[model samples]
Structure formats: structure tokens, C-alpha cells
Target: MAKQKTAFVCSDCGSDYVKWQGQCGDCHAWNTLKEIRLGPAKGSGRAGASVADQRKGFAGALDSARVLKEIDLDAVPRISSGAGEFDRVLGGGLVSGSAILIGGNPGAGKSTLLLQTMCHLAKSMDALYVTGEESLQQIAMRAKRLGLPTDALRLMAETNVEAIVAAVDELKPRVLVIDSIQVVHTDELTSAPGSVSQVRECAAYLIRYAKQSGTVLLLVGHVTKDGSLAGPKVLEHMIDCSILLEGSEDARFRILRGQKNRFGAVNELGVFAMTEQGMREVKNPSAIFLDRGSEPASGSAVMVVWEGTRPLLVEVQALVDDSQLGNPRRVAVGLEQNRLAMLLAILHRHGGLQVGDQDVFANVVGGVKVLETSADLALLLAIVSSFRDRVLPTDLVVFGEVGLSGEIRPVPNGQERLSEAVKHGFKWAIVPKGNAPRADIKGMRVTAVAKLSEALAALE
Candidate 1:
């Protein structure tokens, strides 16, 4: 028998090291190094086999180099995931020979969404569902409870990578789903499942098989406490697309956003509502996020944000209260804290609103996270309204970036945003001067502001 070999690997960055250290040189994460045992070398027993035979499970073929212009550029058709919202986030549809990683918190309905999709796709194509975390009985029970057609879809409960690949070779499935890569292990490595070495190797082998076989691979991944995919960072790079399912525990809605996509645009958003039946796609997502009461309230302002190819209208809420402590508290939910501090300073400097001694709290309604600068003006307006105990008009919509010099900056896709707001019956809009439409839009009044002071005056 060949002697076993061991090496230290960083859990955070997947960096290999000859010896264990306190800190990883690449990622600088402290105490993340873990020992792993490697398998024997290839061709250990078969001495006469060629190099190609020894690397049977590896993906790809030997081909002669060709000129870039001479290579054919035929477009490959995409497979529909059976859910319109899901397909939208995937840049229209799922591409063959692609590896997609989807992660989310527990009870976020990651499994439910994929099961529903596979059941629908299996009606027309050969699809396989492999579960490493759940049992075959549990899956069948869920499907039966959800009233999914169980006749066509193939199911397997296995965790060994080699066995799964062997079954795939025999079945020749056009689409395959590994219900999480963490629990799946391989015979090549002695490390336990979910370890850095195991996840990295198993994903590589499966991705290789998918690429060579032209199979659509959907991988369900677990999220860390911080809501990021739980595995080696390289797992993200090896896949064709990386998406995340986001929703709070108490919230019934889930948002699927693509963080990385090689075939389509990134930052695309998809909305779904968890029902007793299963996951239902929300056609009008903006309505759900903008579901406020009939009466207008203080500290609330509406804003239009561009999400991928569409515009989303969401509400921004703020609370400003007198601080009893020497140091006032600043809290921001579903928005960046540092940006809130910066916006507060701009409000004081440019808008002449002094609330430094007050406790400021900001929140984006419906649990939607706003990462763009278009929410700057809306957030400042909400803060000012709350400070003055004034209620803004319910028909008003606001969007613009506030600069350090108090000038309002324009955001991309301005016309589309205003049109979306208008379609939703927003009669008034406060936008940057550059975003103002050349032709006046019917049923809507536009207030184009050049500076922060001008935006504040528009409120009066």
C-alpha cells in the first residue's frame, strides 16, 4: 500500500501549505488552517496505462488549437428552469454544460424551489435529482405533499462522488442536481465531507463531468453564518453562475439574486412567495415591496431602484429621536451604515439639517437591501420628514445620488425608472437634473434638482 500524505489547507481561501500556520498568507484569516489527507497517486497499480487512462474522471478532450475567428460561434439554446422568475435571474434561461451554485439560509426554501423546477423539466427531458443531505423518502414525501408529478423524475440518495458519477454515466441524464456539495465526499481524499479539500475536489470532478457531457448542473450550497456560501472560495470561481436566495425567517417572500454569471448579467433579482403549495413566482414584485397603508405616514419615502433589467419601487423609512446618551446611536437595516453616516453629514452640510445629537435609524421596507446610490436622496428625505414630524405625499417618488458637494448625481436607466413609477400611479418624482426627461411624461410631475438644498426645498 502507498504511504498516506498530509497537507495543511486554509478553510477561507483554500490555499495549500506545507505546514500549518496561525494565519493564511493569501487571505490573512487567522487560525483557518486545517490538516487534510490526500489519496494515493494515479496509476499506482496499473503501470502500463497511458496518462489519459489514469485521468479518466477528469473533464475535457485533447484538441488542436484553432484561430479565434475561425471557431464557430453558434449559440447554444438554454433550458428553462420552469420558473419564470428563476429563469429571469439566470439571464433568460439555463444554459447547457453550465454549473450553477445556489446558496441560502436554512428554511429559505432552496430545496423546495429546485425540486419544483426539476419535476417540471423532467416531463420533457431526462433529469436526475441526487440528495446528499436528505433521504429519498423525505424528498418523496415532500413531493407528494406538494402534489408534484413523480412519474418521470429520477431520484437518488447518495453522498459518494464516484458512485454518483458512475450512475450518471449509466443513466446519461441531460440535467443533474446535487442537493448541496458540502455533504458529498469522494474516495480520492481521506478528509471528511464538507471539508475544504473534499468540497474543492468533488465540485471539480462534477463540473468536469457536466462540461464534457453537456449536462445542466445545478448545485445547492449551504450558507455560512454571515450568509455567504459555506465552502472554499474557489468553489465560486469554478462554477458558471453563483446565485443567492435571501429571505428573513419571519418573511414569507424570498429574493433570488445572481452574484456572478458568465452567460448573463449579474445582480439580477427574482421574487417568489412561499405558499402552502410551494414556491410561487411573483409577477409584480414592486407591488409587494411597496405595500403601504392607505394613509401617508411621516418618515416614509418611496424610491425607484434599477434591478438588472427592470426598475423596482421600494419604500425607505427613518426615525430620528432625541438622544439621551452622550454619544448618539446610528442604526441602518438593509442599508449600509457607513453610507448612512456620510449622508447624514451631507444633510447637515448641504441641506442645513442638524441632527447630530439625535438617534438616527434607517430601514428599507420589505427587507430589500439597497446597494445603489439612487436611494441617497430618498433616505435623506425620509430622515428630514421624521425629524420634523411631517408626512410626505403618498404619490411622490424620489431617486438620486447625493454627492459630497451637495450636488445630486444621476443614476443609470433614469427614464425606465420614472416610467415604472408612473405605471404604478406615482404622480410626482424628484430626480437629478440630468435624469429629467426631455419630453414631459403624462400623469406625472417631475421636480429635477441640481443640489441637495434644492431637493429639500422641493419637499415644502
Candidate 2:
């Protein structure tokens, strides 16, 4: 006979926890202990309900455990998102039987991208969008705003997983899109919608159906006040791919960032600017973010911020002014605060700049929040330029990091950054001290900057 069945669940990883504790042994999320259900000890747990588990007792009796078996490695035909930025972020688009969990703050355009993608697929394949978060009339209004085709796209507003699956069985959709999975619950789970148990149960059923039937499932998830996925942590592990739609509250630009991809690259980002018609693709982002027609102004410099494999040239602006009060202020936006402090010290000591008694304010134009340390050189140069009240050359781009000793550090894939700059019509590139150009892109002059002093001298 099977052991007693229990609903032990971990507050941290959502892994079943039979006993209570101060900390979650798995995943190490502190203070994340909760007894989701009453269950017996681990030895009395019921067997997992799968065919694979039934073979547990036949391992030795079965023909020699196949040590090495041929496996299928080739990827299936993929569906590309109409937007290049979006497609690249999803590692060249959606794979068959993939359950993608996308979580973001309110107004992050999660629904916009998902619906548009479904509409795009509905043109060729059968697609069904089940929205537990929005009513049919609401979705129709939004579809009208999106200029969607009435016949190709199908919508069902349901919150029950059993009913949703039945509709899927009837529709036999090639692609299924669920907007805000937190709203959908299961009949088996007594927990309410958006709760830990409900989200966990609903996600498990959808994931199981997708894997068994090879249907591409797209899920829109919610974010808690702390900006984490609103469901149990295990919900993230159950999905094959996870993306976070991040941006401002007003939604000027949206960043589609991938956290986990069974088939593609990680940390890939796609930038999209919100418009009246819909989310518009920014083909030439550098031109829009970086000032093109501006004269070389001191206290401003351009940088090649690496977003995954792609290099984007962004403008870094710094302002250094004499501290009117005894204590100076340090302010940075779209940049790390700790690194700014380090760079300031470097400028004051190694570069012989008098910034200690001055207030500094730094920003990356166009609302881009860059995390690359490669922005170091540009930041330092911008500080110097701002102090000198001069601007950098309008035709130039800066690429490199700054060391404590005031030496220029080379960034990864410098060649890619250079080519992108050249394609964007940048003429002069101030790179690391000893870096060599990978290819001579015509119309662009490369300048090797060894130190903070050397770069300032060249600009002067």
C-alpha cells in the first residue's frame, strides 16, 4: 500500500516541507518557513503520480540499465516574434512545448507583447488566449486598440484550470497564452486565486499539459510589492523559460529580460518604446538615446553598454560643481552608487582632479539603467568634461572600464562595440590603452586611451 498523502509545501522554494524551521534548507530564502499542509514524516510520503515512478521497483529486474542511449538533440522549427529585440531576448523565439513565465510590475506591457505575439501566430496557426485577469469585453476593447483580426484570434475569460484545459481540448490550439496565471486556480486546491497554493497548482497543470501535448504556453505573472514573482518560488522552476518585463511606471520604454531559457541565452535584453499605436521597435536605439547633432561638450561622454551580445552606445553625463556646503553630495541615476564613489576617488587622487570638495551628479541619458562596469571609462571622462565645462567630440564613442590606479580596462567583445559604433556613423573611438581594432570599419577613427589623464588631454 502507498504511504499517506500530504500537502507539505515550502514557503521558500515551494518544495514540500514536512517540518517547520527558521530557514528554508533549499534555495536559502531566509524567514521563508511555512507549513502549507499537515503531512506525515518523509518515510510515509506517498509515491509520485507518474509512470516513471512506477518502474522504481523494476530497476534490477529490468534488462541492463541502459547506460548510454541515443538522444534527440536537434531543435524543432521555431516561431519568431515579429520584433527583433523581443525575438533575440527569447533566444531566437519560442520553442515547442515551452512554458514561459513572464513577471513584471503594473503597466509593464506584459499583456501587450503577449497578445500581439498570439495575434501574430493566429495569422498562420491556431492560437487561443485565456485571460483570467480581463473580461472578454475588456479584451475586445484592447484588441480593437491593437487592430487585431476578429476571426484569427480567440479569447476565453476563465479562471478554472480544468475548464481552461477543456476549452484547450476543444480548440486544440497550437499556442496558448494565459494572461496573469495568478488569477487561475484549480478545483482540487482549496486555496484562493493568487495564493501560494492556487498559483502553484494551476501552474503545475498547465506545465504538465504543455509538455505532454507539445503546446507552446505563454504565461503572464504578477509581481509582489517587493518586485518578485507573485507565485510560489517553485512556479518559476516548473516553467521552461522565464522573462521579466521591466521598465518605468509610465511605460516610455520596456525592457524584456530573460532569466531562464532551456533553449537560449540568459541575460538577453530587448528594448521597446511605447507609442500610441502599440509597442514600437527601436531599430536605431543609439541615435535616439545619444545626442547626434550636439557639439563636443565637456562633462559628457558616450559609452558602449553591452546588453547581452549586442552593444548599445549610450551617453553618460556628469556634473561636478564646488560644494557650497561643507559636505558634498553624490547623486547617480541609471548607474550604480558604489562604483560612482570609487570613480570619484580615482578622479580626485590619480587624475589630480579636485572633485572631493565638489558635488557630483551622474546620469545615463534616455532613461537607460546600465549595469556594465565597462561604463567606467565613459563615466570618468564625463566627470572630467563636466568639471572642465567642455563636451566630448560629437563623432566619438568611448568604451572601457576604469581601474583604481587610473588605468583604462578593456571590456569583453570590444570589436562588437566598435562595429556597432561604426555602423551608427561614429568616427572616433577612445578605447583601452593597448587594445587593437578587430576590423577597420571605414569612416571611424580609433584612439587608444591609456589613462584618465591621456583621455582628457586628447579631448582637450
Candidate-wise lDDT, in order: 0.91, 0.79
Clashing pairs in 1: none
Going through the candidates in order, what is the number of backbone clashes in each?
0, 10
Please report how far candidate 2 places residue 304 from its true position, in Å: 1.0
Off by over 4 Å in 1: 1-7, 36-59
Per-residue lDDT of 1-460 in model 1, one digit per residue for the tens?
8776778878777788888889999999999888877664333326787766555543444456799998765657888888999999999898888999999998999999999999999999999999988999999999999999999999999999999999999999999999989999988777789988888889988998887788899999999998778988878888999999999767899999999999898899999999988999998999999999888889999999988889999999999999999999999998999999999999999989999999999999988988899999999999999999999999999999999999999999999999999999999999999999999999999999999999889888
State the lDDT of candidate 2 residue by residue for 1-460, as single tens digits. Answer: 8664545466457766666566677776776654343333111224664554333221111234444555344647778867888888888878888899888998888888887788888989999999887788987887789786667988998999999998997888989998879899877657678877677767777777776567899999988887788767888888888898888777587878888888788877788888766787787677778764435556777888888667888888898888898899999999999999998899877788878888999998877778888898889888888888876777778878889998888788888888888887789998996665856768888888888888767876
lDDT of model 2 at residue 65? 41
Stretches of candidate 2 off by over 4 Å are 1-18, 21-30, 38-75, 291-297, 324-327, 438-441
TM-score to native of every candidate shown: 0.94, 0.86
Query: What's the residue-level lDDT of 254 in candidate 1?
Result: 96
